[model samples]
Target chain A: MPVQDYIRDRFFPHIWCPGCGHGIVLNGMLKAIEELGLSKNEIVMVSGIGCSSRISGYVDFHTLHTIHGRALAFASGVKMSRPELNLIIPMGDGDALAIGGNHFIHAARRNIDLTAIIMNNRIYGMTGGQFSPLSGHGIKASTAPYSTIDHDFDIMELAKSAGATFAARTTTFHIKEITSIIKKAILHEGFSVVEIMSQCPTYFGKQNKLGNSFEMMELFKKNTRKIGSNKKLENKNLIERGIFIQKELPEYTNEYSKMVKIAMGKKNER
Target chain B: MKKNISFIQGNEACVQGALYAGLDLFAGYPITPSTEITELLSIRLPQKGGYFMQMEDEIASMCAIIGASLTGCKVMTATSGPGFSLMQEALGYAVMTEIPCVIVNIQRGGPSTGNPTHVSQGDVNQARWGIHGDHSIITMTASNHQDVFSVTVDAFNLAETYRTPVILLFDEVIGHMREKLIIPEKDDIELIQRLKTTVSEGVDFRPYLPRDDGRIPMADFGGTHRHNVTGLFHDMWGFPSNNPKIVDGLIHHLVDKINNNINIIAKVKEFHIDDARTILISYGASARTARHVVENRRSRGERIGLLELITLWPFPSHIIREKCRNARFIIVVEMNFGQILKEVKTCIDKPEKVFLANRVDGVLITVQDIRTILRIVQ
Candidate 1:
């Protein structure tokens, strides 16, 4: 399947910055969706505010570009009504964590059947380089002039603690890994999250003097280590980039449908 | 035929009314004074093969219903003041996109969670202008459970007809108060559904363009045409447009769609206003008190009247100006610090004649409170 087939091609020339990792992550998602033979009409892409939210506007699917951090809530409504339709949510670090963090935890806790793609660009790119929850301590940001005293969130750990049945981490440099992991997350029956540590050469990169887009991609290459890659997570500097967990918990809609069936049964009996 | 009147709460009346009016889905977060609506819906909607989801929060609850409404469902959410506050942003989204959904905000006292379990009609103005944008809204109020039943049906009807979010604004007094309600059968109600587009297949349909009737034709997601629905100002084809001409049309149509149809949208009940000189203007629980005073005063030949507003928004300015023209004075009664009182004054030639009987002590405005105001004005 061609990549263009899954896009509203006219909406291309997307608003992501030049050499921004968001476009690569978006392409990976498009390729994953196309490879799965999913019909764009039967799929709905939801997004919150940020640089990444523009993904919904560009996608040819039934897209909803909603309020900052409310995309998951809106997507839940869509999925609840039309359980047969697949839902995908793409969000940036600040959008998924700072403003929408409550929704993220609760949505995962429900184990709702949806794919949440958290593109971790490390800083607030759209708002002109404010530090994010994923922007680690000692990072420089427009908001963090004296080196941020705050620690960053381990997104995969957050997802797992919040009862996400499928949680994984990959970077934009690991293109094949993100694509395959996204496909796996989509096939998972419960709440699934794929945290892609994509570089933001414009914001985090320039602010921290971490080189350009190419250098930041190299930074991800040097640090990340997939589980069972003969490397242990005991090393504090190493990043884990494999499926953290995939368990068989009942998806939200399916259990709700069971209750629906029981209710309908009582109605028929009456 | 038999009168099937039964004792019920105002919140329960909304459930019965919604079921009768083809309620297909309910997405809400439970809050005090409004939780009963969600509890009953949890059991009833599924039994009727409709969708009900206890969303994670009020924001999601509002967002979810808008999503369901897009796929052709008559959706609703119930909340009190605090929860309704969380819903304001998404409410603006619904208004901006022209989606049809109902929001039942049972009023609770508050600047910030002032009195959650107590009653106050303080949110009347908030329900209208709370969303920060140039837009118009439909707001209905029910004094008792019976009015709650019929007006909920009407709320959904107006939401679908005008394609806007309708507010069923009441208070904890009415919501929790037990009143005799006659639930209508399915065949006995007038239900309105969203107007489906007739634009042909394979042709790119302009989903936001006003049809010949001055209303946009909506095509659901997964319909023949994959038209876009967005919060940003968009063109006829549903694509985001920065063109000045298109943005002008978008903003104008959003407010004008409901403003142009105020006559069909605004609803009020007049009591003894025909030959009265001193009148009391009120809605929701306060109106109940005002009605009692009006009835008693009229019996004593006091020449007093009550304009009970069932529909509070699109503010009904012309109706107030016309109905109260003969009155020497009008007391705007409510459980707030002069919210609707401002709107009442705006509609009258003698703005000074419209006086306010404001109350915000977390108590329902009583008949005595209104009677005293009536005496002072007279």
Candidate 2:
């Protein structure tokens, strides 16, 4: 399928900064959608306020650009309503894990069948380089003019602990891997989180002098190492990017469908 | 959706109303007076392959309902005082974003959760202006179990037709009372879903773009069109901007949609206002007491009238003004401390002539309470 087939033609040459990794992430996401064989009519994309939230505006799907930190909450409702419809949530670190952290955890814990793609571009790019929850704690940004001491969040571990059945991390630099992981995440039957370590070559780059877009992409390629284990690891110790799946308890859909069956007066034969 | 019919309570009537109106999702934390609503829905909604979940709290429940509504599913949540307070923020978001949903506030007495098991009509004002913002709403009240059945169905219809959040403002008495309600056949009702139009794929769908009459169509989630929806005041293409001109334009449209269509939206039940010297206006459970007071006075041929508001917001002020033109006094009886009375007073220039009969201590308004006010006017 043509990329044009899935994109909002009016929002072309997206508002992202030149060489920004969001465009690359969008490409990977669209590719995954195509591979899933899902029609745009059967998909809903919800996003919050941030640089990454703009992705909803460019996708040819029924989309809602909701308030900050509420995408997961909204997506949960949509998923719970029509569990058959494929729901995708795309938000940034700030929008997803920082301000919307509570909703994110609860949604994953509920094991609602939906895919959340957290674009982890270390800083708040839309508001000009403020330190995001995933930003290295001591790194200096607008919000942390002086060296900061606050601990950064571990997106993967947070999802895992919060009941995400599938959790993985990749970057725009690993285009094929990000697409492949997103495909598998979509195939998962419960809450899935694929944190894409994207490049904000504008704000985070200008703050840390990380140079041009290609330079930032190189950093992501270097920093992310593919790991193949379910064991927990300390963020301070090492970093790896790969597919993680935990198919434990039955998903929310199964339970909800059962309740619906009973409500409809269909007696349980068991 | 499977169609079935049965005699049920007013609360259960609300569930049938929701089900027949194609309400596919219900998220609520069960509370007294309103618990049967969720109970009935929990059993009924899923048989038709809808969604129903008892959330951890009223806040999450309200948010979940709002979330589902955006996906083009008719959804609702129910709660009383404290739970209603928790829902205020999301209620404000619903108002701003124009996500259509219904909220059933089975009111109880309260400065704060005064009585959970009893009846009161307080929160009438909170229902109108609970959240701080400039917005208009569709609010309806049910005086008896039958109205509970009829009005709740009306609430869902109005919410979807207007693409605005509608409040089914029920007090404890009506919410919990068991009464004969004729469960109408599916053919007997008219269901209005939010308006959706076919737009070419890949075209930017502005979810908030107003038509000529200032009503905007909502985008159904997962429908092959991209649209931006937000809490901020947005322009047609859903771009955020803070221009005062655009603000005035949008705000005017928001208020005008219902204001222009008031004839269809405003509802009231009037009694014996012809040649009456005084008019007593009441709604919700208090209307029962006011009706008794008026009926008693009428046996002696007293020239008294009753204006029972079925639709509370939009105020029905025009009808109040027109009908009460020759009246000497207007009495507003509510369970709250003069909440709806204030709105009545504001709509009329002579505020002093409008009397208030309030009951704020978690008890139902008695006939004697309204009679005391009526006797003063007499």
Strongest candidate by lDDT: 1
Candidate 2 residue-wise lDDT, B25-71, digit = tens: 88998887788888877767777787887776776687778778867
Among the numbered candidates, top DockQ falls to: 1
Q: Give the Å shift of residue A84 in candidate 1.
A: 0.3
Report residue B156 deviation for candidate 1 (angstroms). 0.9
**Local accuracy of candidate 1 as per-residue lDDT tens digits, A120-145:** 99889988999999998999999999
In Å, residue A251's CA in model 2 sits off its true spot by 3.2
Candidate 1 lDDT over residue span B82-197, tens digit each: 89999999999999988999999988889788898888988888998999889999999988888899999999889888889999997999999998998776668777778889
Tell me the docking grade of candidate 2: acceptable
| Model no. 1, DockQ | 0.72
Docking quality band of candidate 1, CAPRI definitions: medium
lDDT of all predictions:
0.88, 0.81
Clashing pairs in 2: A43-B222, A260-B46, A263-B43, A264-B47
